[model samples]
Target: MKTCRFILSSGLMLFAAAGFSQSDSTGLPGDDFSLQGALALFKRSSSVEEFEKLLNTESSNVNNLDLNNDGQTDYVKVIDKFEGGVHAFILQVPVAENENQDIAVIELEKNGNESAHLQIIGDEDIYGEEVIVEPDGDDAGTAMMMPSSGARYDHGPAAWLTRANTIVVNVWTWPVVRFVYSPSYVVWVSPWHWTRRPVWWRPWRPVSWNVWRPRRAVYARHYVVVKQRRVVGARQVYRPMRSTSAIVRTRYSASVGRYRATRTSTTIQGKNGRKVKVTKTKVRRRR
Candidate 1:
């Protein structure tokens, strides 16, 4: 009887291990998302008012990001750069202040295959050490520390208990971004740079990952659109460029996980080639 019990216990253990492995490795049916598809999903499901409210918050124990650099923390927003289809998801965390503070931005490709990179810009003395957490057990990710009071990473893993499918890091591109320094206009004491180039970015911590229905199946799909601008009169523009004014038709976004754009209209496109009419969000920049 003891021998039989031992065999059964071992089998059960093996089964549990198998289950965990499968659960960890296996992603959702459409885990890999396209930019156009994701934008559709976000628009169809997300509440515009709720998103605006989130962006206007002055302070919150959770998701408090000072994007503009004005002593106070401003709200966060997602800027959808639509070229032909979609370009990238810009996680814009603005700070509150008179002069424009250095914005915190994380640019990501909708369907990056595999690559990894982390660059934290600001004062090495003021901000101090970085927190590098490889959460998700086997799945890979990296985050550097920034100077923030709420849910900020100082010198440890910015552990995001996120579903494996919502965000992904390509090991091949482990550290795609290079420098972390201040740009021409600097405000906050901490190090930060709003990179025009595309890089990986996770949302502010303590977000409602399961804000959507069907709790377990939800991801960070809530977002409104913002326009992205760059210095014109440049050379060899690959992707589409965003106009500060006017919305354009849907062309779909291309994934440049570890790579590299040029411009288009403001109108957004929905599923099955349905054009979703949206007003242009006038972004104000102060110096």
Candidate 2:
């Protein structure tokens, strides 16, 4: 039963690859690359040589580095033969991280031609395991895992990462029913561990009025300064009073009670032509 399942899986992979090859030959250029194409190519070519020759038309040197510091070097690069034309990709893979041994290298090339080549270089580990992914169920867009993971998103064809005895899973569903879109990529890394998670999905909802309500009205105080000169009363004129002398011996004495008083009053006007009254109360004599 296990052998039959393996053979069935292998046959399905080959069929998918052949379908992609045909599509590449005939599909319109400058269109968004599909996940289906990536999966098909990923399945058909397991080594760098096979990937490059199968998907690309030319080859160039690619530098290798351990981006994750996993001790084993893993690298993938693409070179464009024409100044601005199709690109050829190459990738190198090692059997294991700790071992000094080398594993498979594959090459993929893209030219105007539709047919791709797949070539294998060096000895391959036949026992090496490959990750298998497929639709979760008979549902048109649903994706499921053979070993289930807890996380799920609304729009999906799900993805999973298995490492260090733990499987991290991410499932997403498309919001639009008819159109195909790109999936968001997320990465998580730890010492000795690394994985990717798909973007979180949420339904579109109308914005809440409470969230955008205007804040309480604020009032600020301001003052203005005005300059104006005020005019008082006009100048007043004073008249002198005469005193009567009293009859006596030798030097005549002046009688203080015999004097007559004269009074003066003035009127003042404001800027608006309003009249204001002014009174002179008393008179004084200087000796």
The RMSD of every model to the true structure, in order and in angstroms, is 22.2, 48.3
Locate the minimum summed-lDDT window of 10 residues in model 2.
230-239
lDDT per residue for candidate 2 within 190-251, as digits (tens), equals: 11111211222111222222221111000001111111100011001000111111111111
Clashes of 2: 32
Best by lDDT: 1
Candidate 2 residues lying further than 4 Å off, grouped into runs, are 1-34, 57-287
Model 1 Cα lDDT, one tens digit per residue, 1-287: 99999999999999997665444321211112112222222222233223333333322122333323233433334443323211233333322222222122223222222222221111111111111111122333342222233443222234332332233222222222110111231211212233321233333433222231122222223221222221111111212322110110111112111111111236788889999876432321100
Tell me how far the alpha carbon of residue 4 in candidate 1 is from the true structure, in angstroms, after superposition: 54
Q: How accurate is candidate 1 locally (lDDT)?
A: 0.27
Candidate 1's TM-score: 0.23
